[model samples]
Target: MVSQSPPQSHQIYPDSDGKPMADNTEQFRWIVTIQQNLDWLFAEDPNVFVAGDLLWYPVEGHREICTAPDTLVVLGRPKGKRGSYKQWEEAGIAPQVVFEILSPSNTLTEMNKKQVFYDRYNVEEYYLYDPDKNDLSGWLRVDRNFDVIDPIDQWVSPRLGIRFSLNETLQIYRPDGRLFLSYIEIAQQVEQERQRAEQERQRAEQESLRAEQERQRAEQERQRADRLAEQLRRMGINPEE
Candidate 1:
């Protein structure tokens, strides 16, 4: 089914207007990281839904709703563009996963409120990441209840089967244990795969050429043998040998 987001309260106000929206550099950096991993994570698992800058309505008429979860994933949901995800419209199901990237402008009280909202809405998994402090703490819901999941030296996602570890820097896991590609790294990998394929094609062509040359040489030798046999027959001796 298609997404059914509530009507947006949007206005065409520029930066000069001093609009009432929060924007910060730390937030932008976290967004970049999430955006970069979107395709990789999607490739690894298609059932996962990743969204950013979108609206989510937990309650239709009540006063609680969240939008644009820096990054979020709803397992078993269709991956596509949507104006917003209205909880009531999505089979009365809320997002299974939610991630919050911390910004310096955010306060302890504000973060606590978001945590409470997620707990009330039944978000199955909640993760809070602080890039500045390299702090990543998470919680997993058990029996519809939130429980703290402590961060470790190497973060492993129990739900996604993906590992996030630092090897001098934060790196994701590939299925075969190699590092998962970052945005730029993925691009380079694609190019390298293409080059390797081209090299294989060239090798195949060279092998074919060598095979043809060998066939021609064999044909010439056969002809020479036939001529010798004919000469032996003319000399009046048994030519079978």
Candidate 2:
């Protein structure tokens, strides 16, 4: 039998030498929310996997390095856990969609640096969301260059076949007309609907039991009256007279 060699080691620096990374609560929460939403949405569509800030290394000879994005979508990778993403390990495929949610801590230089990194790695799309001023921007990789796409109030992802819309509320709707909300919102709504349905079923069952008991009582009373009348008739006291 062939023996397997030990896996290669990778280096992880807590900070990029004072570089800005996903280390704060606000950035962390947005990433988590987006990831959970995408997970539920793609459960029925598993070809794509979405992840929040994780390490990714793009080249083989160089010790590749990356951390989770605000949200990242890989078109063909199986959804699962890993210490980090190694480009060569993934058939030389990088994430097709990468998202960055802007926070006060992020500077233009840092953001631009990531843009160049993703571009060199052949990422197909890059999207950014800024909650501060609600700045939403998107870009597509074209001919070895990253070109910005005009912000669309609504658009469709050719990769996942789902529509992304920014109405008064941000919503992602599936083709079957079902809506996918953030994990917290989806869980709360499902719980409410379940409670309502259970209450209705209980009420209906109670009403059925009540009606059955009343019918049985009425029948018993009628039989008792008949027996008393027969007893009086047999006693030679002419009740009719």
Local accuracy by lDDT, each model: 0.69, 0.72
RMSD of 2: 6.1
TM-scores for every predicted model: 0.76, 0.74
Q: Model 2: runs farther than 4 Å from truth?
A: 1-25, 45-47, 64-67, 142-145, 167-180, 214-241
In candidate 2, position 111 carries an lDDT of 89
Rate residue 213 of model 1 by lDDT.
100
Best by the TM-score measure: 1
| lDDT for each residue of candidate 2 in 148-225, tens digit (9 for 90 to 100) | 776656666666556667765455666566676656777899899999999999999999999999999999998998
TM-score of 1: 0.76
* Tens digits of per-residue lDDT for model 1, 109-156: 988988888888888877777777767777888887898876544666
